[model samples]
Target: MIQIQEPKSPWEIVHMDWVTALPPGGDRSYNACLVLVDRYSKTPMFLPCHKDDTAMDTAIMIWNKVISHTGLFQNIISDRDPKFTSALWTNLHNLFGTKLSFSTAYHPQTDGLAERMIQTLEDMIRRFCAYGLEFKDSDGFTHDWCTLIPALELAYKTSIHSSTGKTPAMLEKGWNPRLPYDTLKKDLVDIHPTASSFKIMLDKARHHANRCMQDSFKYAKERWDKSHKPPDFKIGDLVLVSTLNFNNIKGPKKLKDSFAGPFMIKALHGPNAVQLELTGELMNKHQTFTVVLIKKLQLK
Candidate 1:
């Protein structure tokens, strides 16, 4: 997030996304799809699955990828997608004590980061993949998925970061993560002095990243949510949610009917937030939401 500080912890403010493509040259992945990109590290983990995968399967895949590498974050902001709101999936996440926020139903700002990444991914996959799996061999096919993903990750990290003028990975780890490009940089000169030795260099980068983070947070917090306070949540309160929708629509949040709710508060979150279990009506249509957006359900 350009407005956020360099992340010091996973899910401090992470982005989530999904991507699709044809099977790597030789591989025959059923769904021709994979979920990639964790907000914290900005790393791509390919979760292979089929189009028929249920909300349970998708949630399990997400849990496997997240816990295996980053444990859990304080919050997860996702779009109002059916799979994200499925009863079984919601119940499981609640068990972990992670706060989940649904972006404005039709508002793209809910998951803007993921939307941008999707565009970049499409361009990358198209460039590396053959026309309709006509590649000469499996080697070439895998090169597109595995090799290209890492390459893109590195490229994205080393590029100009809007938040700190450093890569996202750099901010997260306090140093540029190792990648294929690091090995290829042997011929390069250290134009800037990080430290006299390698260990010292890493320490210096980390320190700088931390400093940048402090500075960034100072601004981010003041700007992150400008209201005087976080939303007011209470037990048994009825609330409406403002969700973002980025499917195929183009519009403004104010104009979007993304707000869906009036669900009863299952419990009050720490202070300014709450937990809501969709009612039979909402569940029948498949709904998911976090209480951060509640401004007190409009009275009858």
Candidate 2:
């Protein structure tokens, strides 16, 4: 299994993914949402986007919604989406001194943070749609999807996260944002600390959050390692890849070949994935396969 390193500070690493195939909504006919999550603080930004947005369009939207507000981050982890893998996107990040890492084909665990966040966002949207709430934008235009984003974002940011034991706003800003419930209680008072004291408090909060994240990662790794073992195949090794993801294969799955190839390994991707020397029609497919989807072939 590939071990994901915990970030030392907020926004040091960010994970990004897109939620697509959504019903077209809003005046702009937005059909997708770009999800970006800070690896350290677990903070998220959900930007409305079109399903067919080009690489340059995605880059511009990210700049306007996230990078412009948070400044430059050190690294970004994402799936091999066309927009993320495009030369334009890679070159732009290279210019900004940011490293881009892509997860292995068919492996979402590498960008688990963003994937989980997307699930949460989808659940919220489903519930909202069920209630059939009517929400309007600042222009007084009714938007089916875009208008609900701000409220959903606020609810997600203000709630305590299970992994960090802190709310995203608390971890990132070092202070809990006031909620409407605070206004109902007369016992609540507004206390503003001095600049130096505020800085000290922020540092303490970050330190605590770091510890919490480390502990969470340790526990998760231990549990995962109990059932998963490291891959042993190396370069030039003969292996057989599972046909689970192949779509071109016809006939009943039970009757179809369970695995294909005796393809030779071209390279190793970390400890969990590998690149294979595939030929024929397979060349049209992704050559990289997760270790679980391939096994070392035993020669007769």
Candidate 3:
């Protein structure tokens, strides 16, 4: 598990991902959900979408659904989805003051929270559709799964989370929300804030949250450091690069080699990053690969 530190408050650090490639539904030809989660509060938004949605579409969905409500966030964590990796997404975030952090190649655990949420969301949608909710569109195509998504989102928001010991609704709104199952109807109450004291209280809350986050980060770093084997790469050494970052490889993907290789290491860019010397065909395809993506080649 990659131990990433948590942000101090809701929406400060967010995770965006796609729960995808499902059988199409008739409502809007929807086949996937764009999932966004706030790391601190664990509030999640599930937007119904198609598998082929472009990077522009993703940026628009996020701005309309998320930024429209919460204003601007500080950071976004996601996997190496093409949509997230695109230059458009990078520029959009830069225009807002948010930093984009992509999970390392082949290491999904770097964005484990979002991946786990997507799995849970899939399970919820599957169960909801299995309760005899199938329907036919005007053209007689089966339209079963899309309608239950709203209900699943509602239930997920109200349920108490184990990590924070509070429902996302409570953390986001500062109170527990009353569900439809409650016989007694509850009304929303507003509290009047005293002038300077409100700011003082807010400052104290932020201080405490920051302290807790630092402690959590310390524990996680210790665990990660214990199991991590440092990459002992040297200059002028030939290494095999992982194919997970390559998209233009020839031949059937299954038959393709896992690692494209014999690239000589020219220099170390950073502790874990490397610059490789590529000549011939691979030269135009790739230039630099991280040490994590390089494996030692055995000679017979």
Q: Which candidate number would show the highest TM-score if scored against the true structure?
A: 2
| Model 2 Cα shift for residue 155 (angstroms) | 1.4
- Between prediction 1 and prediction 3, the one with superior TM-score is 3
TM-score of 3: 0.61
For all candidates, what are the clash counts?
A: 13, 0, 0
lDDT of 3 by residue, 17-111 (tens): 67676666646777787777777888887787888999998778777877877778888777667787788888888887778876544433243
List, residue by residue over 1-300, the lDDT tens digit for candidate 1.
Answer: 122234556445544444444554324444334544556555444444565677887777767766666667656655555676788767876897766656543322243345444444444443433343231232332222432333334455555554346666665566776653245344446633322233333333334333433444354445444733545566777777654532323356567667656787776534434556665334543232333445577786
Deviation from native of the Cα of residue 15 in model 1, angstroms: 2.4
Residue pairs in collision within model 3: none
Provide the lDDT at 30 for model 3. Answer: 79
Best by lDDT: 2
Q: What is the lDDT for 36 in model 1?
A: 49
Model 3: how large is the Cα RMSD against the reference?
12.1
lDDT of each: 0.49, 0.69, 0.64
